[model samples]
Target: MPKLRVVSYNVRGLKDDRAALGEVIRDLAPDVLFAQEAPRRFRWRHKCAELARSGGMLYASGGLPGLGNAILVSMRVTVEEAWGLRYPLTPGRHLRGAAFARCSVAKVPFLAVGTHLATDDTERPAQAALLAATIREAGGTTIFGGDINETEGGSAWRTLADTRTDAGATNQTPTFSVTNPSRRIDALFADKTCTVTSYSVIDTPAVRRASDHFPIYAEITL
Candidate 1:
């Protein structure tokens, strides 16, 4: 069995305390990191690379191409393929997309998707559907993660729940507005083939200063 830790976070476009952001990320020591709100313009790629290196991880995929999503990986992970998808346009809505990678850790393979759904209630369902479809098309034990911008009862959340295990649901940890911390918008959903070994919302002074949302991680075995 191969056990790996996956983390999902929203960096708020690197407008906050980046050093604290790097500190908390390094502390979590994730194998795969699903980052939402990555710098989307003006040297975005270089910024993404710097962000990944800060945590001793490699930038794998996503960023501008995925709208605001990005994925980073630890050295132990081998990335076989990497790509991104921009979702269909809905009038007046900001674009959204997903970052994907076919990766293997310790020789056990899986597909990793990093995404950020629409904050507008009207746009989330379609984005969620696209995410699910991407996972289906990729066809493997998939690790889906990032900010869905809704609660467990929301339609978009339920749509994703239909095909994957909510690795952080049971913990019921809220992950938004670090100052208040009352909403649970960030998550990690894994295929049934993976067993959840442990899950947690990484919280500390550094995490609070990192971004508006706290990062969540889960230890899953495949």
Candidate 2:
């Protein structure tokens, strides 16, 4: 069996202390990283690559096409396919989408999907539905990570939860507004194809200085 460490974080467009963000990422040391609000315009690719480099990982997929969602992988994983998806846009709302990569860790294959959803309560369900459908269709073991923009039990959260097991169910600690954390808006979900051995929230000085939301990750066996 192959076990992997998957991390999810909302980088706040890397507008904060990037070095601090890098430090947190380096410490967590993810095999697969799902980044939200990654640079979306103006040499976005370079910025995404730089982010991966800073974490000592490879830029696997996503960026502008994923509407700022991205996936970065450490050298241990071998990427086979990579792509992005954009959801139906609602007028006057920020664009929403997902990043996907089908990869193998120590020869065990799995899918990694990273995303961020709209903050508007009414807008998230549809996006969630699409995301759930895509995950179901993706097949095999999966590690889903993202900032859902709402806490658990919300419609969007439920939609996706119904489609997979919430890795954080056992320890639902908050991940937002790092300095004054109050919500668990970020998450990592694992499909039945794998087993989540542990879930964690990495909160440290670097995390607070890195972005508005703290980083969350899960260790799973496939």
Write down the TM-score of every candidate: 0.97, 0.97
Report the poorest 10 consecutive residues by lDDT, candidate 1. Answer: 163-172
The residue ranges of model 1 lying beyond 4 angstroms of the native Cα positions read: none
For each candidate, the alpha-carbon lDDT, in order, equals 0.89, 0.91
| TM accuracy, model 2 | 0.97
Residue-level lDDT tens digits of model 1 in 107-185: 8899999989888998999888888887898898998798999999999999998867999778888999888888898
**What clash pairs does model 1 have?**
none
- Residue-wise lDDT of candidate 2 within 1-222, one digit each (tens)? 988988999999999999999898899999999999998899999999999988888999999988999999999999999988899988898888999999998888999999999999999999999988987788777888999999998999998888577989988788888878899999898887678999999888888889999899889888
What's the C-alpha lDDT at position 147 in model 1? Answer: 93
Candidate 2, lDDT over the whole model:
0.91
Query: What is the lDDT, from 0 to 100, of the residue 140 in candidate 1?
Result: 88
- Which structure among the candidates has the greatest lDDT? 2
Off by over 4 Å in 2: none
